[model samples]
Structure formats: structure tokens, C-alpha cells
Target: MNRPHYILLPVNPYFITFSLACAFLLNLMPWGRLIGVPDFVALVLLFWNVHQPRKVGMGIAFFLGLLMDVHDASLLGEHALAYTLLSYGAITIHRRVLWMPRGVQVFAVAPLLVVAQLVPFVTRLLMGAAFPGWGYLVHGFVEAALWPLACTLLLMPQRRPANPDDTRPI
Candidate 1:
């Protein structure tokens, strides 16, 4: 079923804050070498890209990515570049995702997520950082696996209203 685009403005800020908190929490979650959690921030951004492109797009992703870089103390601009590219790609494909089944949308986003991770890894390697090894890709796998849940949790039909004016635009 097609979903509405009405936004919930008054409550939107709280949701964004909650999502951002979730992002940081997910980032802090500890996992052994075998499995790593996906970038919760990126996943949240992607959901917004597909369902609320007008509200959250490249700029937000880039800004958040920079925050991540500072918080994580990783290579400078590493997350920023990946986020910029991924957000751009997401926005570019935003319209197409609207008609796609949730599964199909996950398929479409999974690779982009993987590629986004890879870019920073490669950039770090180029800058003389030690290779992180195959385990580095674990986050991608987690991201793909978590796709449906993320969509359901963040993209609920009631969350989107058909009329933009019905709720807050952002």
C-alpha cells in the first residue's frame, strides 16, 4: 500500500533526537570479531532518505558523519566522504524506492551501505592505516540483516501523512 507523506512536526524533533541517540548507542554496542553492528546513524539516515527525502538528505548525513568521525576518533573525513556519497546515492534513488517492496528496497540499499563502509576503509589504508581485514565487512552484513526491522521501526505508515501540511515538514 502507498503511504502518506504528512509529517509530524511537533514530535519530529524528539524522534530525531531519539534516532540519533539510538545511532550512538548502536555504535557503542560491543560485538566480538565475528559480527559487528551496522552504522545505526547511516541506517536511520537511509530510512529518512527513502521515506522522508524532503526532510533528511545529504546535508544531514554529512553533518552527522562528521560528528561520528569526531566521536569515534577515526581518520578525518573518512566517515564524511562515505556519508556524503551514500546520502547522495540514497537521495538519487529516493523516488524509485517508494514503489519498491521493502525487501527490494533493502537489496538496493545493502550494497550502497557496504560500499560506503569500504570507502573509508580503503581511504584509511591509503593513508597508511593498517588493513582492518575481512571482519571489517561485518557491519555491512548486519546492516543488510537489520534492514526490514529498521524500515518497520522508522518508516511506519502512520508516521507519514499524505498531506505535507498535515504534519511538520521536517
Candidate 2:
């Protein structure tokens, strides 16, 4: 018996930047009235951090988080701190997380997202900002829940045809 072999296509750096830009724009979109809108930029950054740690690491996450702070007019360095920690966590587990199946990967990443969210929330609290209540955590959960979908969409461009001769049974 022969099993189909699939090869992953190389991803362009420009495509990754473009996707991150799109996620930033999505985050900027007005959804103030909504209760639990996910953080698109953080989600994208985390995804890239896990899949391409060499290309997307702490510096990019910090820069992007700073940009997000300016976009949202939030406390300076709040998002930067969170995103930096998030990137660190992702990079630390990049190999292990990549080894897991997609479904398990989602769960594995949830705590990282939560920690990312917690950083900003804690920063705000220390700065005299009022607690936003448990509702604030919903966004992290939403981001985690959408992980599978985001991975599928982002990887679509990287799917390539397998070599005909490479198909072999184990």
C-alpha cells in the first residue's frame, strides 16, 4: 500500500508581513459595542511565533504590541510587555507545540494567550485602572477557540503538491 505524502510550500516573508498587517487592521476596526471581540493581532503574532520562530520573535511581537497600544490609545508598553512574554512562551515551546496535532495545539496555546492577556490587565490594575471584570478573559478564550481556523487559513498558502515518488507505505 502507498500513502500520500504532502510537502509544505515555502512561505514568503512578505506574505507573513501582509497577514500581520491585516490582523492589525482587523484589530483597529471599531467593535467597541461588542462584548467579546478577540485580539486579532495577538492571535496572528502567536501563530507566526509558533510556526516561524526564526522570522517572528520577541522584537516583532514587541513592535507590533507597541503599535497596537498606539492604535488603541491604551497605556504605553502594556501590550508590548504582554506580547513580548507571549512570544517568549511561544518560542520556548515552538518545537513541542508543532509536534502536537492541531486540536491539541489549540489547547496547549490557550494558557499562553491567557498569560498574554493577563500582563496588560495586570499592568492596568497597577496603574490605577479599574478592573474590567471576568468578562475581559473571554477574548483570550475566543482567540484560542479560533486557533484552528486561523492555522488552516494561514497554512493554505503553504500547501504544495507532494513529489510523486515520495509516496510510500510505512
lDDT of 2 by residue, 1-170 (tens): 25453467778899999999999999888886155788898899999999899999999999999998897789999999999999999999999987777789989999999888888888889999888887887888889999999999998888744443566532
In model 2, where do residues sit more than 4 Å from their true spots? 1-5, 162-170
Clashes of 2: 0
Best model number under TM-score: 2
C-alpha positional error of residue 125 in candidate 2 after TM-score superposition, expressed in Å: 0.8
C-alpha lDDT of all candidate models, in order: 0.76, 0.88
Per-residue error for 155 in candidate 1, Å, reads 2.6
Candidate 1, 1-170: lDDT as tens digits: 66554443333756766786788677666653345757888788777777677777788888888888887788878888898888888888888887777788778888878988888889989999888898887787688778889877765644665565745554
Runs of candidate 1 with Cα error greater than 4 angstroms are 1-11, 30-34, 157-170
